[model samples]
Every structure is written in structure tokens, then in C-alpha cells.
Target: LSKQTKDPRKKVRMLALAHFFEGKSRYQIAEYLKVSRTSVNKWVKDYLDYGLEGLEELPRSGRPCKLDDAQLKQLKAYVLDSIDRTEGGRLTLEDIQQYISESFHIEYELSAVHRLLKRQNFSWISSRSI
Candidate 1:
């Protein structure tokens, strides 16, 4: 199961518990797994407290996205539709940033705009140019 699992962290947790079941000490498990003893302890504690579900990653509460799903879809559609309207049929980061600020009333820096584009699978490299 650990080998088949995609999440590397979860795989480590499973291996730690496997070592625990084998009657290995926390120190032995930590050394074998190459993870900190504290991490091994936490994993064991979480497993004991909540069973298999605890082995899964908890939802992280990070900074919320400026554009929600619908808005993001709208932005993507606008970008695709506006391609022909752009200069040289290419949309620059500045163009996207300006559109987001004017249309969505949310100003994003160029770096943030680049990240957004990357998340949306919009590559800077043009297919035709490739």
C-alpha cells in the first residue's frame, strides 16, 4: 500500500506504523524511516487517536484564492477569447493583470498573475512557436 500510494508523506506514516506493529522502538522506527522521532510519535499518536483517517493529510487553511471557481473559469474563457484581439495574437502578463484588475476589481502583481496562469495550465510558450 505504501509503494502504491501517491502521497510520499502518507507512505512514510504507513511505514512508521508498520514498524510500530513489528515491536520496534520509536527511535528504531525514526532511524529506519529517516524521519524525526517527534514525527514518528505524532503519527503513532494520530493513528491511535483517529485510526486510518488520521494518517491522511489534514486540510490546510492557507490564504484564500482571490478568484473563486466561477471567476477563474471566466478569466480563462476571457483569455482564450481575447487571444485574437491581443497585439500579435499574444497576451502578455501585463494584459492579464490589467484585465483582472479592471474586470474583477482585484489587482494582482505580475508574479501572482504568472502563478495564476500556471495553475490554469496556460503556458507562456506558444504551441505554434514550438
Candidate 2:
């Protein structure tokens, strides 16, 4: 079970359980595992309250994306297709922002637009006349 578990916390919990089943005190377990006594207490409590599943990390709440998956896919396609096209010339961040606003009817801040572009692996390059 320990070998199959990849997370270090989970492995520690497994070891704690093993020591617990071996009639070890919480202080003893903490000393042997080199973890805090509070952590051992919490692990034992979690195991008793919710079994092994409780030892796993809880789900985190992350910031939701401004655009949905379909919108993102459409944006990617538009950016890729617009590259090297004569109609719009080289695409810029402002141009992409305008396109997004026009297509999605959502206004995005300049920084947000830049962040989205970067997240999509799009790089901005400046062209200079020789």
C-alpha cells in the first residue's frame, strides 16, 4: 500500500496506521515517524472518522477561468489561423482582446488578456523595419 501511494503525506499516514496497529502511543508514533504529535493525533482522528480516504488531501478551490472550454478552443483556433495572414497582418494582444470582446461579448482587462495569451503558449514578438 505504501509503495503504491505516491504522495508523501499518504505514505506517512500509512506508516502511522501501521505503528498504531502495533500498539504504539501517539507520542511514540510521532517520535518514530519524525512528525508532529498533533499530526499523528489528526491522522488517527481522521482515520477513525472517515477511514483511509480522509488521509488524502482535500480538494482546493482554484480561481475559475474567465472563458469556458469552447471559447478557449475557438480563441486558440482563431490565433493559429490568423498567423501569417494578410487580412489582419501580425496579431497583437490588443487585436486579440478586441476579437475576444467582439466574439464573446466579454470585456477583459489588458493584463488579463496578456495572461490568457501567455497561458495558451502564445508569444508576443515585435517586428522592426530594417
* Candidate maximizing lDDT: 1
On TM-score, the candidate that comes out on top is 1
For residues 66-127, could you state the per-residue lDDT of candidate 1 as single tens digits?
Answer: 99899899999988887655344567789899999998999899999999999899887643
The weakest ten consecutive residues by lDDT in model 1 span 121-130
Q: In candidate 1, which residue pairs clash?
A: none
Q: Clash totals for all models, in order?
A: 0, 0
The TM-score between candidate 2 and the true structure equals: 0.49
lDDT of 2 at 38: 97
In order of appearance, the predictions have TM-scores of 0.65, 0.49
lDDT of 2 by residue, 1-130 (tens): 5577899889999889889988999999999989999999999999999998889988779867789999999999998888856665567778889999999998898888888888889887755332
Off by over 4 Å in 2: 1-62, 86-88, 128-130
The local lDDT score (0 to 100) that residue 57 gets in candidate 1 is 94
For residue 59, what is the lDDT in candidate 2? 70
